[model samples]
Target: MTFSPRRPLTAVLLAGALLAGTAGCSTFSDSGRSKYAQGEGKPAEDDDASASASSSAEAELPYDIRPLLHPDKKYYGLAAKGAPASMKSVKEFASSTGKKPNMIEFYSAWGDSYETTLAQNAWDYGALPFIAWEPFKRSLAGIAAGKDDAYIASYARSVKTLNQPVAISFAHEMNGFWYSWGTKKATPKEFVRAFRHVHDVFEKVGATQVIWVWSPNVINPMPKVRLEPYWPGDSYVDWVGVVGYYARTGPSTFPTLYGPTMDQIRAFTKKPFIVAETAAEAGDRKPADIKDLFQGVEKRDDVLGHVWFNFDKEADWRISSGPASARTYREQSRSSRYGFDVTKP
Candidate 1:
């Protein structure tokens, strides 16, 4: 993430409740169903009338899943971390960038009864939704054991309503020691089982519109907890997303920061690679770092895309934090390879 939850580690927000109710619905209430859309753990029909309206979306149904993996197209996305998850706000943020993001990123937590409002809006705006689903205050083992099926099923149906393709990444950065699912607190077995279990439920409920992204934090800093042991395999993933940043000062190149980790990932799967979260901290080389970061990834044929973390915390990571940095980004995005062509409804 561009920024993390301050309480992901020790916060047990769901202490006595099995799940959040209407009182805590997420940014998905635009359709009024996110609040009352309950799952009895069974597939429910939306009726002939609703289905008729959805027929158009259904025809547009199989939503183009190729852009994310197009062999010749390079996709560029954005993650406005800590910002409102509404489409209106998302558009305003993108407008400020002088470039629109092909994908808009949002966040969700385990047992957090949320809806797909952002996803719907992103689709309407021709942008793919990239959801960063977290497993806070819960153990991976419990999720893998089918304890979270009802919640997962409900989410699946909601996406089914979306009727457009969306990308879902669960427990991102599992190898990092900050969250409960990190290597120090959970085993690789638990992580793999939980991921497969969630994907299986999504499959069972017929939420095939989803594009699964197996995301992990870079391992150059922690070789002991290699990302390979935690991978759920090709059949379970459609994309390989990695998160790494240039947090230091002085001049540096992209390979210097991400080459070794990318090499390690190549040792495993050939899934399309996405720099799910990346930024250059405001330091001695903030301007140069931004230039190298964009140019470096732009030159890689194997990189499907890159998402910039547009936030102003923990070292002014926002592109506008520095004038030179912002200018470089705006100019670089003018390239034809910085794909902004999205599918709109």
Candidate 2:
């Protein structure tokens, strides 16, 4: 779950900068109100005949993310520095792995404007944009009490205006104690309330295009803290994102790392899970660990995919850290079962 924190500078600085230039901007007014509203700001219902007609009359978009909702093949993704903004690192990763990633993962701090450029870049590159929306300076209790409604509403509207599918993993790795929203700073009840509140705001603004991913760090490191207490119910979650890493001191095999966590999750909900963040350490055993990572994902039907933490932080976790590891990654990840055209049906 650990990687170099490369916050998107352009994205944070130029929030909503694309709306005025993009063709989708035509559907919104200068006030940024959605055209879907009718009869003096009445919200449109899915079953409303007029609303249905309005939706059909909209121009066709290039990105179609339904395929990613229930992907027949595992998603090949990467989390690297300057991704979705530059894609230089992503391209290098693709070159080494012999295939372009179908999903791009990035981090977004709270109070920053939605990174429309990041989303656009991911779609333009034939990939899905996955955001790890971290509420760094904000308190979970204050968030739940609607103190941040204005900010949340503005952010959600930006996503709605884009009208493209995006996956958001809000306040990820909450089960761990290192982060502000984790066990040390916040309670499970407070976390659940804050999560539900954010999800509700997005729903109220008709940003239903988002795929809500509830991610938590693996339980192996913190066996004392249970994950069930933080559950925000099934309605608010579309995917269970599990975060873990293969380290020399930690669990090296997939079964030892993710099995117990997955087993505990199955006791509550049947939602499909993904290895949201993972990487192998740099060492002689990295090649074998890399092979095991790919093979482990390939054999699990419920595992949607994994996003490799391709950055050198704390340890050499990059895929190209060593010749043998790089070669093994290229060879093991060539499976036809790993990546697919997310834009296609």
Worst 10 residues of 2 by lDDT: 9-18
Q: State the number of backbone clashes in model 1.
A: 1
Candidate 2 residues 231-282, lDDT tens each? 8999999889998887777678899888989999999988889889888878
Name the runs in model 2 displaced over 4 angstroms. Answer: 2-56, 60-66
- Candidate 2: give the clashing pairs: none
Clash numbers, per candidate? 1, 0
**How far in Å is the alpha carbon of 285 misplaced in model 1?**
0.8
Cα-based lDDT for every prediction: 0.68, 0.79
